[model samples]
Target: MRAVEDYANDDDAAPLDMLAALFEARGWPCSVRGHEVSGEVRGSWAKYQVKGIWRADDRVLQILCLPEVRVPDDKLGAAYELLGTINEQLWLGHFDIWSNGGVLLYRNATMLGDDGTLGLSQAQALVEIAVEECDRFYPAFQFVLWGGKSPADALEAAMVDPAGEA
Candidate 1:
């Protein structure tokens, strides 16, 4: 098992490259964006968006990564509360949330119901849920490369098949 600290210190670009390569290996198309967002109340927020498809469905999975420091404790708490509300409001097909050091990964799941208009509170909530879930599934989260094959396999092995080993 790998420590969260080790994974956290690993290069962000390395994972992005590995993900892109995985997608390419599977013949899936992808787009990656690394950007910084600044706001009056939020100061400066760094975010990376890895958007693409793994299957024939029009659905797109977006992997969001943000610095832990950018997410305040109060905001994170609020996000968790909102996540509960969102989960109650809509049925989540599938999802996972994981964190390494100060970075968090929110991926899986189909787009939010209703044309993706999951208000700020709800969005934050979803992120919180994803983070928590990821922590529960440590090293496995890091194995997810592209086409989401690794994640799918991990979920099936760890969650779906209760009797199976992870």
Candidate 2:
């Protein structure tokens, strides 16, 4: 793993390196593992594991968001339904639950184009979008898994604008 400073100094570093530097510059503690940069981010609901991976050939930056909780077996169906609906509402990322562990994750990506010059601001926004999307839909997962609410109801509640809160 290269130091974040190394990435910061090299304008021609790989996508992963640039992302790590950008994240570090913004005070996010990220470590480069192989080709991915991962860190922990705190959200309104819980802590989330965030990973950034760069596909050099594709000029893509993939950001993944993973929450700490696991979805119970009984709630798998509801969780899947919520993921589908919530994914539709999202503009930048999609929610998916792992089949093996029933763990929900949010994924989004930014295309750096053929030239592979990704601006610092764009990279930061890509990572930020993944985390924000996870925090936004996290309550729906709680509702389905623990509150025993239907997927539709949970999604509705999550989307609703609470009165007098602004």
Candidate 3:
């Protein structure tokens, strides 16, 4: 087995740099600090705070997209249930609520393999997926937390796709 120091010492910030660049190219406000890149993206329902972290040891790039909605104390259980329902419809990442603050977020990750090189397209896809999913499900979260709808009902109400712009 490799020494702990060997595993901990080698960390590359390039992946996060690429993510920051991607955000800048798209005109999204992003800040890069060490191994993390964080910024905000506007979705249909709300503006989301998006953060990207590079875990060099695991060769993983993780992204978190946090919506503006907060789950109240009484709605925690329903919110959790809605997460399960929403996650099932997701093809890429899943939604989760923070245990400490009851704040909702979408989490997703991609492995860069042994080479540890994250392509621009891959980086773009990761952020795009997070933003898209958050936009798609933000209303469902509202339906559960504010509308007092069941998970099933919230999903149904939020997923209605109308045919064209009005």
What TM-score, over all chains together, does every model reach? 0.26, 0.85, 0.88
Give a tens-digit lDDT track for model 1, residues 2-34: 222333345222333334443343344444445
Descending-lDDT candidate ranking:
3, 2, 1
- Lowest lDDT sum, 10 consecutive residues, model 1, at 35-44
Please, what are the lDDT tens digits per residue for candidate 3 over residues 1-166? Answer: 2222232344332577667767777788888887788999888778999999889999888899999777899998888888887888888878898887888899998888797766666777888889899988888888888887898899998899998889
Ranking by TM-score: 3, 2, 1
Which of the predicted structures, 1 or 2, would earn the higher lDDT when compared with the native? Answer: 2
User: What overall lDDT goes with each candidate model?
Assistant: 0.35, 0.78, 0.81
| RMSD, every candidate, angstroms | 19.0, 2.9, 7.4
**Clash count for each candidate, listed in order shown:** 6, 0, 0
* Candidate 2, position 117, lDDT: 64
Higher-lDDT candidate among 2 and 3?
3
True-vs-predicted CA distance for residue 14, candidate 2, Å: 3.3
* Minimal lDDT window, size 10, model 2: 3-12
TM-score of 1: 0.26
